[model samples]
Every structure is written in structure tokens, then in C-alpha cells.
Target: MEVEIISEESIKPSSPTPHHLRTYNLSLLDYLVGYPYVPIVFYYPNHNDNDNNIFQALQRSLVLKKSLSETLTQFYPLAGTLKGDSIECNDVGANYVLVLVHGRLDGFLHKPDLGLINRFLPLEPSFDQSSVGSRVTNVKVNIFKCGGIAVGLCVSHKILDGAALYTFLKGWANMASKSEEVTYPKIISPLVFPAESLRLRDIFQVSYQTVLKEAALKVAASRNGVQQPTRVEVVSALLWKCTIAASKEAYGIQKTTWLNHSLNLRKKLPTKTSKDLIGNMMRVSSAVCKDNDETTLHSLVNKVHDSIVKVNDEFVNEAQGDEWYVAMHKLLQQMGEIGSVGPTEYYIFTSWCKMGFNDIDFGWGKPSWVSGLIGKGFKGFFNLVTLMDTKCGEGVEAWVTLDEEELKILQCNPELLAYASVDPSPLSNDHVI
Candidate 1:
């Protein structure tokens, strides 16, 4: 598909407030302090039919101008914190939000001209040398010539988790759609009711070490930093193909097993109000190897599903009430004396659709296509799945990055190659931006 590059500019930065952001009240404060950076992009597709114009869509989406910013300002301390020595909002002035506009011809091709998307993917936030909350950059809008638009937002994870972000986005969309008045999100502060506890040892008989090892092994076997695996390479060749094979063997073609991955804890929570939940409250549930002759997809998925259920049971048994919370505090105190720590590895699968970016309608309309840029630190042992809308065409568009050897394996996989060929869409060309 032919592509075009649009101009890049920074959005006006929000100012920061004085005072060190308090983490004591928020449960998810650790996330803020540890991995404060979050990149969010909104995709808007062109409206060939007479849907609402992009601006009208935004107007209908109430979260656009009021509730979102207000929510961010109200609960998320990171939103009000300064970047460097200055007292400006930590948001990097870069139009962290992107808008892409693509034409119907380009959209019909299905595959995104990589050249067009690449141009705007590598935006870095400009930090002030001297500021505290001053390092502010929030939303950015980028428009593509193909009539696709993307709103790129960079937020500090310290403040809001994926669930919180999604909730805010949904609220924004609902408001923008003018479908309802702003409803408050339910806030469940993990800090108020933390998850870990000492009684867990008594409640669940399973060994924590064993479970951690299993999860780590699965991730290690699937991904090694030496070689990365793009979502397409892994899903098409390993995940989906395995599912198909497993389904065929188990219950014939009539029965199929699908993978249902969960978003982070923040998104799944009830939203009457916002809370300061923190830590690795994220959970991911998926079917294991299905296509392999050794195991069926149903069995694999069932095993994982059962394991998750068991873990939840343990969580419920150990971390339920004020007594459990007290036990958890004691456990933390004891562990602190011995210098103990939490698990380092966990898995979660999420799609861009949850971020509300996929449906962002700017003045021009929706984006013909969209994608997440793979940044640094994502290599080796990390399994992050991103989703994008299929440009108007025969098949969908997916972008992934894997290690060299994995790439070779995927290229040689007949099942995967066959699947790729099934889609008549054109392959991506090398155009950045």
C-alpha cells in the first residue's frame, strides 16, 4: 500500500503542582515509581458512510474535554507531579496522542504501509533539565494520508494501570458519544486492601515457588531475549495453529478452543469510583499448546484455567478481610526483615481496543489503521501482545517482533505460511511514517 507522512508537533504541556506525590494512600504506587511510563495510541478510521464526523464524535464522547483530565488530576498523583526540577506537569510536551488519516485505496489494501506508521512511532518526550512535575506531555494526534488517525498518549504507569486507563477512556468515549452523563468510576485501592498475606501459607496448600517456576518456564521457552517473537509469528505459528490442531483431534472441526486473555486488574474492576490499586494485580489466562501431538488445546487451556482458579481460591482464602490485611502487613514485616521480594515475572495479553484509542474520532474521521511501536526493554522473555484494526481489506493487519531464530522458524512453518497466504491483502512496504 502506498503511504504518506504527516507533520509532527508537540501538544501544550500541563503544569505541575508542588509537593512530593504521596504513595501511602495508593496501593499501585509502586507501579508509578517503578514503571511510570505508559504509551497509549488512539486509532480513528475514515468514515466512508455518514457516521458522525470525527469532531462530532469527540463532542459526543464526554471523556474528551472534561472527565478524563479531571480524573487524572484528581486521583493520579503522577498526573500532577513535575518531570524535572521545574514545576510543570510531567507530561512530555510531544503530542503524546497521534492521529492518522488514510484514504480508502490505502485502507482497502489491509496491510499498513509500514513506512507511513514508522514516521510517528519513535517520538521521545523532551524532559526539562530543571523541573519536578514540569516534565508534562500528555496526548498527541497524528493523521495519516491514508485517512487513518492515531492518538498517542504517554502516561505514567505510577498513576493509572491499564484498567484505570481503559475505564477513563471508556468514560470519555461514552461521554463523547453523548450516550450518557459522566458516571464516577468505582475505585478499589489495593493499598487500602492489599492482596498478599501470611495466612496464604495455610489457605492454599500449593507451593508458590512451583507456580512461579511454571509461569517463568512457559515464558522462557516461548521467548528468549536472544530472539524475540512478534505476535504474528508466535500466534499464527504456535498459538493459533496449535489450537486448530488440538481442536481437530479433540472434538473434530466442529469444536474449537479459543484463547481469552485478560486485561490488567485496573480495567476489570467495577467503576463506581477510582482507586489506588497497585502492584502486579494483572492476570492473564490462555490455553496452552493445543496443536502439538502431545497435547490438545482443550486440555492445555483447562490446565491453565484450573491453575488460575486455584490461585484465585488461594487469594480469596488468604486475603479476604481486615484480619487478612493485618496478616499481610505482618507478612510484609517479616519478609522485610529477611529481605524478601515479590515475583519478577508474570504474563498479560491486552489489545489496543481497551484503550479507546482504536475508536478515537478526530475532526477528519477514524483512522484507516493503527499499531503500537515496540520500544526498548521489551526484548527477551517479555510477551506483550498488541492489536490493530484491519485496514479495509480481505484480511487483518498485525505487526510483531521476535528473535532471529524464531523468525526463521515462523517463516518455515507451513501452517503459518498457509494462514498468511489465505489473506489476499498486500504485504507491507518499507515506508516510515
Candidate 2:
């Protein structure tokens, strides 16, 4: 698990950003994101024959840097620094580091240590100004002893969410592979959502990891006389239920809990093509379980489903207008009122399940595995769950962050264990690339 720094340099855009696009303003949605940085790693196994592997790895590394330079021209804002409320697209360049890992990639993935994943990235995913600073994007290319490579990317959450992040990755991969189907970023998110000044609160804690198999997803989605719940809904409901139960057990009494599921606002927008727009275009579908509420899995599923359904096209239209300001004010007001009503827990659930992270191939082949942060090696985050698609693309891997005591009780929950495997190896699936 020892990683050595092989090289470090900044990758500037091959072409200068147009003067008109120099200052990219932050959208209101971007300002609401709790974390300042988003980090992920893509593990690509060696595919070349033994003799050719070393040469191919070196050549591919050059291609990656070259293509990334070209890609940054289109994603110009990413190469800039975030200052105050806007990105100063002065072509300061992205932080790119090359590292050499001592062990084989396979051995590391066999029993992947969530705590050590941060080593792959240039910076930790936290809100600390000193650690994150003004850097808008950071990339680390990790070369393993077995010739496999792991590309770790850390982008400012102020600029992109899961959808936008995948868009950028796919575009970069397309350029690296010399594909004709080049993906271009549409940086119109700020024009659509506009920017506003606001302050947000922060929370801190540790994490736990679990993977919910597709079989469990099917069972959780089962219900009579109702439309099937999505894997996201079912998993979120189950985790919310289990965490609430854990909290009640750890403490002495039931406490009101709130679950917030983040929804991508691309498809709901007036322009369906906004799906390709790069920025934090998202909203939250919130549901609450009162102290005396029914905490059944089925009941929780319905609640989650209903809350999600409410954020449909019609709501999106209103959210795009004046209702947006009114809603923001109401949310701020509600946050203040909650403190006076005794103890309550809040959990934020975000899905990267169908974002196509596994398909980001850069000439060699698709990645064998992709990973998000498991909330280790940093602080200022808690009661958060990030659900990602498994390598096989059938199951959901939930990276949960909670307080120590609550997470301890949740680890031994029989119902949760029946439906999910805790921190399983990435190579457990036969279909991995």
C-alpha cells in the first residue's frame, strides 16, 4: 500500500480559453453543495503482453497528458482557480501528479482498504481551505507494480456533480482514444440557475461501506399495488431505516430523522440536452420520519418514492422561477427552527449509480473498478451515503458515513447484513473488466 511520487506537474490547456469565457460564475445550485471537492478513482488493469506492457504504459501516460491538455481547452474553467464566487480562468493549470504504488493492483483491490484510498488522490475531500485551496481540479496517475494503473481525479464540487463529472471524464477518454465521437461540455448551468450569495453549515464524522446485491434490490423493490421502487429508492429507504434503528438503540429514545435524496435536474429542465451541461444542476427530495412515525421498510420506501416523484417536470419549472428564492428562504428558516425542537438526525443520500463511471476507457480498456470517497482520512462530514454502481453494473455499493456509535450498531444489524455485504472486495464479481 506504499505509494511513491514519480513526478508532479501542472497540465495547462493546449489552447487558451476565450477571453469572453474567462470568469465562470458559480450557479446557486453549486453554492449549496456541502463539500468543496469531489474525489474518485478508476482502476485499469494491464492488458498488454509482458514485454509490451512497460512501453505501452509509458506511451499511454503521454497520451493521457496530451489528451487531457486538449480536453481542458473545452473544459476551460476547470484549469482555472476558484476565487470568491467565480472561477478565474487564467489558465493557471490543473495539478497533475504521477505516483508509483509498491504492490500489485489486484492484491490491493482484493481487500481494498477504504481508509487508504485517499493516498491515490492529490488532496483529501474536505472543506479545509488550506487543503483544498483555489485548485479547481487535481489528477493523480498511479502506476502499480503489476503494470495496472489507477487514475484518481479530484474536482471542485463547486463546478461539477456526478453527471457533469462523468461528462468530463468521457470527453477526456474520447480524446485519449482518438475517437470521433467527441463529447463537448455545455457550460450554461450558471445562465440557467444563476448565482446567489449564501452560507452553508458543515458536519463531520467517520464512515462504513456496504454493497447491496441486485437480488436484495429486487426484493426491496417488491410491493403489491404500487409501481416498483427504483434501486436508489429501495436502498436509501433500507439504509435510512437501519440507521434510524441504530440511533435509537445507541441512545435511549426515538428521535426524528430526515432523509435528503439528491436528484439530477438535467432531464427535468426545459432543455433536455441540459443533461450534458456541466455544473451542479441538482435538487434534494426530502422526507422526514417523526419520532412516532412508522419506520417499516415498505413505509419508508413509499415516503422516499413520493418525495422523489414530487420533483418532476412541473416542479422543476417552478423551481426555475421565483419559487426558487422562496424555497431557499424557507429552507434556511426551517434549519433554524429545527434547533429549537430538540434532537434530530439528518442523512444526505446521493446516487452515482447510473453515471457510467465504469465505461471510461482511455485506449487500453474500460476500468475494472471505480470508487468514491468512503469518508476516511478527513473530517467535516457525517450521516452521508453515496451509492455507486458495482463493477458488474448490477448491484449498488453504498458508502455510508455516520458517527462511531451509530455506525457500530449498524454494522451488526441482521436485516442490513442479510441484504448487503459489508466492504467486500472489488474483484468479487465475475464480470469485472
Candidate 3:
């Protein structure tokens, strides 16, 4: 598990960005969310023989850096430094770290040490004013003792979301092989989601983790034929249910609780945005569940679904209006009053299922695993759980970051455990390409 820093390199864009494309403005969604860095790791098994392993690793490293530089030409903003509310896309460059790992990749994969996995990451994300500075992205390539490699990338969430990152990863990999097939990501915020309207900030917390197994979710879905909860709905409801179960000790069934989740506004837009459209295009939708309410898993799912559905065409259109900002300004004053993370509050669930993250391939093979860490060292305290695609099949993995006690309560929850298991192996299938 010892990850030693062998060297570090700064990979500048292969082409100097045109002056006209230098300044990339922060979209409304970006300004509102203002999230930190999102850390993603990709593992590649070394295929070279022993003596040639070192030489091959160096060669692969060169390919990665060169391809990354070329990729930056299209994703120019990533290589630039961040200034106030915008990226100076002047081709500053991104951090690329080369590390030597003392352990084999299989050990960590077999008994997956989440902490050890993080050890491969390059930069530690921070929250200070200079944290999300220029050099919006970072790369770490860990060469395992067995010659396998793990490529860890940390991207500024303020710049893009998981979908954008996936497309970026593909472009970088394609360039590594010097392939010409590429799709330039479009910055359509100005046209679709204007920047002036994005004046909200990232507010909210608690620590917790829980998962909803695909089978159990299907069962839950079938029970209520009228309510077919997607994987995200099923998992969100399950997390709310368990949080309620765990909260019984502190607060009885008398208080009101909220389930705060994000809705992707891309599909909700009147004219569908191109899949290549990048930036944070999400809206937070809150569903209330008081103790007097049904409070059942089905009930929770119904509530969440309804709240999100309400954020439809009208709500999306309002995002471009001045009144929306006024409402947000008022909501900002009442943020603390709305709720705080105490024994009673809300859980924020962000789903990344079907984001195409599992499809990133750099010629070695598809990643053995993938995770989205907001680059925070320790887990936070809004019962935050991130659900992602298993990629092996239709199942999804709900990654919750809770303290030991609360997590144990969720882990031991008979109902949840029956459906969603924790940390299923990424290699447990015949589809690992």
C-alpha cells in the first residue's frame, strides 16, 4: 500500500489556445454549486515482461503525457489556471504525477482498501480560497509492483460533472494512442444556462453510507406497479429509510426530515442539450418526509419522484429568470433555518449511474474500478451517499461515507443488506475487458 512519488510532470496543451478561446466563463450551475475537486482513478495492468517493465512503464507514461497534452487542446480550460469566477484558458498546464507502488494491484482489489486506493491520488483537495485555483485538473499514474498501472485523476467539479469527465477521459485516451476520432466538448452554458442566473452556493452535510442491491430494488419496484422507481429513486429511498431507522435513537417519529437530491437539468431542458455539453447542469430537489407521513420505502420513493418531477419544464425555464435568483437569495437566508445536520435533517444523494465512466479505456483495458471522491480527505457529516454504475451489469453501487457506528447500523439493516451489498468486486464478472 506504500505509494512513492517517483516524479512529477506538467503537461501543457499541445496547441496554444487561440486568444478568443482563452477565458472560459463559469456557468450558472458552476457558480451555484461551486463544488470542490472530483477524484477518479483508473487501473491498468502492466503487460510488459520483467526487465522491460520499467522501460515500458516509461513509454506508457510518455504516451499518457503526450496524449493528455493533445487532449487539452480541446479541453483547454482544464489546462488553464482558475481566476475569479472563470478559467484563464491560457494553456498553463495540469499536474501529472508518476508514482511507484510497493504493493500489487490485486491485493487492494481483492480486499479493496478504500484508504489505500486514495493513496494513489496526486493532489489532496482543499476548501480554502486558493484550493480550486488554476491548473483545474491533476493526474496521478501509479505503477504497481506487479507492473499494473492505476491512473488517478482529480478534476475541479466547478468546471464539469461526471459525464463531462467521462468524455474527457475518452478523448485523452484516444489521443494517447494518437487516434483522430474525437468529439470536442461544447461550452453551451451561455446559450442554454446563462451564467448570471447561477448565484447560489454549495450549502449543506452528515456522514453516512448505504447501498441498494439491484435485486432488492426490483422487488421494491414491483410491489408498487404504479411507482417504478429507477435505480436512483430506489437507492435514495433506501438511504432515507435507513437514515430514519438510525435516527430513531435520537429523535422519535415526531420530527420532519428531508431528502435532498440533485436532478440533472440536461434532459429537463426544453431543447435537449448535446451529450457533449459540459458544465454542472444540476438542480437540487428536496422531498419532505415527516414522521406522521407513511415513511415507508415506497412512500419515500414516491415523494422523491414527485419533488423531482416538479422541477420540470417550468422550473427549468425559471432557472433563466430573475425571479429564480430572487427566490434563491431568499432561500440563502433561510438555508441554515431550512435545516442543519443534527440528529434530524436531510441526506444528499447524487447518482452517477450510466454516466459512461465505466467505459473509459486507455488501450490496456477498461478500468478495474472507478470512484468519484470530491477530493475531501475524510468523509463529511450530510449523510451523503454517491450511487454509481457497477458497469459489470445493470446493478448500481451506492457509496455512502458515514462514521463507523451509523454505517454499521446501515450495514446491519436486514432490509437493506438483503438488497444492496457493500463494495462488490469490480472483477467479479466475465465482462471485465
Which number leads on TM-score?
2
Off by over 4 Å in 2: 49-55, 130-133, 197-206, 224-226, 335-339, 430-433
- 349 in model 1: Cα distance from truth in Å? 4.0
Q: Is candidate 1 or candidate 2 better by TM-score?
A: 2
lDDT of 2 by residue, 1-433 (tens): 7888878999999999989989999887887787877788999878554866545666778899999999999999999988877888989888999887888787788888888887887777777742324879899999887788899999998899999999999999999999999797899888887765554534423367788865555565565413678888888888999998999999978888888888998988877578789999888887888888988888888889888998888756555577877876776577557635877888888999889998999988899888888675477778889999997887888888888888889999998887888888888864222
lDDT of 1 by residue, 1-433 (tens): 3334333444321333324533323332222232334555555644443444445433423234343454444333434444321123433233333343445434634654433443343343222211344333355554444333455665544345555655555554554455544545544455433533222211000000000111222343254221333332233233334334433444443222223344344433444233334333443334333222243323343444443443343343343365545644664454344333321112223433324444444334454444554433232312333444343322323333333333334344454343343223332421111
**lDDT of candidates 1 onward, in order:** 0.38, 0.82, 0.70
lDDT of 2: 0.82
Among all windows of ten consecutive residues in candidate 2, which has the lowest summed lDDT?
Answer: 197-206
Sort every candidate by TM-score, greatest first: 2, 3, 1
The lDDT of model 3 is 0.70
| RMSD to true structure for each model, in Å | 12.2, 2.4, 3.3
Candidates in order, TM-scores: namely 0.52, 0.94, 0.89
Deviation (Å) of 333 in candidate 3:
7.4
Give the clashing residue pairs of candidate 2, or none: 204-381
